[model samples]
Target: MSLLQKIQDLEDVLKKEQLTVDDLVAAISSEIACNSYLVSAEGKILSYSLAGSNSDKNADLALKLEFKQRVGFVFQTVANLPLEANFLENDNSFAPNTHMAIVPIHHLTSTAGHLLLTKKAQQFSEEELILAEASSLIAGIYLYEKANENNSDSQHNNIEMVLESLSFSEIKAIHSVFTELNGLEGFLVASKIADRIGISRSVIVNAMRKLESAGIVNSRSLGIKGTYIKIKNSSFLEALKLKVR
Candidate 1:
């Protein structure tokens, strides 16, 4: 996808009623090629993403443990900062030479949370820092909208209407299919989507058939190659992202 289209996708993901902190992390991480974390002002780790191998897992666990232990201190350090971004070569939770950046997430005029980005490299360029700051602003807007929507009765009803007919697994299947098929032609492989979603192939196939019957997707048999799938109605697929906001 073009950079502009990717940005649009991120914005769309944020607006979805099903938006979560991990979704935010995943979007930013996938865009920037690094681990991303969202932490609330109250020292809670809202979401995080670290994609890789066994060493990555070890590092991820250690980082989470350290964050849990020292999140309060980290919060306090930037609690009074303005709408600017900052970087630290090493923090209480990170080793020396580890790269970390902190960006403020504001809701309207007040701060709501912080975005923490980490990479194995020792430093990030000024351009990257600016991008991080911008990403944090987007995340803040998402959080603000989510908070308001959750408190709005009208939004609640709309969300229920959108999700009432879909089961959790079906929703997941739709989301997986939609994300994978974005900006692509031909067809999406159901088994690959099933693997990525951590669900069985049979489940994914059933979900795809249901979606096809509902006009949310077009599915065709490829004989021994299995089913070839394509999203038919993107708006409907987007609506499937509705959450109990």
Candidate 2:
């Protein structure tokens, strides 16, 4: 297939929400007719489809370790190069004919991971190199989107935890003050909240303490500047029934 057509096929694979990096690697392996792996920047093998079989678990572990070391060394060696495919000739006696290509998977300006391909006794064609680069880009996008989703879920969970920790009165106090602020940025005075809501200063202070303790907010006394309040989780606005402004 032409490189453009192969890239279009990879794009179709990416459109599937259920598609994983492993599936993507497998597709790339089939397209290029070689063993493929997706290794994280930290040298963890995220996905792979090796040609040979290891009969023993220990052999598999050793093989994985050796691959990791190889990837790490090559990654460090080419760290200064532009994000592209780099070829290496393997010296391992066990796989004398093995030739490897490493493509750095990039997310924006940062290296997110890598796409590694190994072929026995054959140098990679230009078309194969370009396909690997395209695959790496797709893998980077997939990994980055997954990371964002996980972060958003974690933030939502934290907001729920803080919401569960609050008493009805405390929620009311928080709603009153935050609503009055109307998405204003900067420090807010506890006494100001107390005066506006007709609640005791101690009530406002305690509520802030709970938020701070839950890691949902940050509070610091600015002395005459009242108290510096910074909400770490913006989802708290919707959770507390306040405007998300």
Candidate 3:
């Protein structure tokens, strides 16, 4: 199919009511003939669609971890990554044969996230790179609209009462970890955060309890999946003086 036709198809997909990032990833994956992922600027995997056959569960998990790590590295080090598509050679021992391309998804002048494409033993062509860049622009617009729709006045005031209940260290711990978390739909293991930040799990647990009691956050224990937490109020992060990336 011609690139213009493929992009037109994507535009048709976007016209549907309640279109989602997963839907976008699936459409882009079909056009590019590779696994595609939409990752948040904070390194959270927003959505993904795999091409061809699916990998086993273990390999799939490894791939997600690798993507998160790579995105985090890009956010930390590549402050001025261009809007055009760029390639990253996979040095991961678990998936050494993988070839990856990334395009920054921008919200106006600032980057909001990334569009990632990966396939084994196949390098992306120049045409594919252009298509990916176009896809990123569409994804950015969708995300910006969603963000505006989700904004609430209650979110700005929800943390005022909770602030007095938290200690300095507790606030610091919560800011350090929770800022990385994707709201509601995205969950991370609490122990994993503790391990990564070199803090005791008890500190995280206590902070969560206080926040939950104040109705500022909600959490559910997922057994082996650890804790799934969603911030009810983003103002808490701002109140704690969390640094914006």
Kindly report which residue pairs in candidate 3 clash with one another: none
- Of candidate 2, the 10-residue stretch with the lowest lDDT total is 76-85
lDDT ranking, best first? 2, 3, 1
User: Residue by residue across 1-245, what tens digits does model 2's lDDT show?
Assistant: 77789899988888886887667877788777777777787876676765553322222222245556665655321211221233322313235566777788877767777777777767788788877777777888889988998989998887887777777767778887676666634667778888877878888778879888877778789898787777777778877874222
Note the Cα lDDT for every prediction shown. Answer: 0.61, 0.70, 0.70
Report the C-alpha lDDT of model 3 over 199-221, residue by residue, as the tens digit: 88888899889888878788898
Q: What is the lDDT of residue 210 in candidate 2?
A: 88
Roughly what TM-score does model 2 have, to 2 decimal places? 0.78
Candidate 2 — what's its lDDT? Answer: 0.70
Better candidate number, 1 or 3, judged by TM-score: 3
lDDT of 1: 0.61
TM-score of model 3 (CA atoms):
0.51
Worst 10 residues of 1 by lDDT: 76-85
- Candidate 2 off by > 4 Å: 50-70, 73-95, 195-198, 213-215, 242-245
- Candidate achieving the largest TM-score: 2
Count of clashes in candidate 3 = 0
Ranked by TM-score from best down, the candidates are: 2, 3, 1
